[model samples]
Target: MTFLAISGSARRASTTTALLRALQSAATPAHTITVFDRVGELPIFSPDRELPSPPDSVAELANAIADADGLIVASPEYIRAIPGGLKNAIDWLLSCDALIDTPIVLAHASHRGDDMLGQLRLVLGTVSTRFNEAMFLRVPLMKKTPEEIARLLSKDASQTELLDFLTRFAAYCGSAD
Candidate 1:
């Protein structure tokens, strides 16, 4: 199975990105996790620009999501809400067929982002009918370096829990098809 992992933060060393990297490294041989690192490169979404010929970056994002079996999104709350870049990227997918029934997993890398998570749930719920609210993952990773976070996730217990959750999600995605 193939899962597209998108980090909603634009920072070079974001914890959200780090966690996705760890997920990529920890995935089993049967599964492939590909991280999308160019949310920042996507243009602000506009309906006028979405048809006929979208930007290369937007087309690429849509194609990636269309090809993946499931999606894993990790976002860091900004000012108590989802970041603008991530929101923009999602907006670009509003008209894409791929977003209609794809399975989605949301992860937050902050201790307290319930407000943003709630909003994300609402947004994703509209985009995909199969968005699994139960598969959400949250880890308080503020102030930690990527290396440090990776080390913690590498521990047996943490790795096991994450892999278990992903395995279940993959199974769910498979059955949903």
Candidate 2:
């Protein structure tokens, strides 16, 4: 089974990225997990300019999503909402009719008053994507240290919960599930 773990945060090594890593640890080595952290490469969603042809990077990203058996997306709240970069990627993916109704497992890293998951759901829902389990990281003292945040994101129960969720999806190529 192939699972594409998308880090909604474009940063190199963020809490959101770490969360994705921990999720991968629960999966068998054969599971094909690709992380898309290059939101910066996706151009803005301009219907007119993108009509005749999509940008090269946008096309590639869409193709990848369509081929994946399932998707694990971790979106961090920015400015009390979903970041524009992730929204842009979603917009491009929606243009691909073949990828609609794909199973999406959503995760979020939120501290303060942030409801980015709601917006992400709205975006994916509009495109007819089927949502799976939703995970949230909202520990009280994660601000104190990385170890604390890592522990919360990599908790044993959480990993098992995620693994069980992914197992229910369609056969992932070579996936032990």
Candidate 3:
């Protein structure tokens, strides 16, 4: 199975991005994880702007979503909300002729307990995207030391809670079909 990660944090090595990569690495060997890093380039939703020809970036994103079996969204809380760029990516997806039936897992990271995760869940719920079991944790991973973070990203990540969540999600995807 191919799992796609839609990242809202565009930074090359943001905390949320690093955690997501860790989760993907922790998943069962039967699954393949693909991170979609083009969210920042997708044009904002505008029928007129894209009528003649949709942006190549948008099409590339759509194709990635189309090809995935399941999706994981890891967003950062900006002003206690999901960023407009991520929202626009989802909005542009709604205009596409194809439907994204892949099961979605919503996740977010914040210094405080922010609403980014809840907001993402609402957006996905409203769009008819299947909200499979999701995992949400704060930045720095709560009491984990730098050494622990490094260990979690390595081959032993499966023993961590984040990996446990992905293992559950992977099972859900297999049975949901």
lDDT of 3 by residue, 100-160 (tens): 5667776554455357667777877777447754444343543355466666556443347
Query: Which has the greatest lDDT?
Result: 1
The numbered model that scores best in TM-score is 1
Predicted candidate 1 versus true structure: per-residue lDDT over 29-99, tens digit per residue: 99999999779999888889967978888888899999999999888888989899999999888766658
Error of 2 at 169 (Å): 4.5
CA error at residue 81 for candidate 1, angstroms: 1.0
Which residue runs of candidate 3 sit more than 4 Å off their true CA positions? 97-100, 111-113, 133-148, 155-159
Q: Tell me which of candidates 1 and 3 scores higher on lDDT.
A: 1
The lDDT of each candidate is 0.87, 0.67, 0.70
What are the clashing pairs of model 3?
Answer: none
Stretches of candidate 2 above 4 Å error? 111-114, 133-158, 169-177
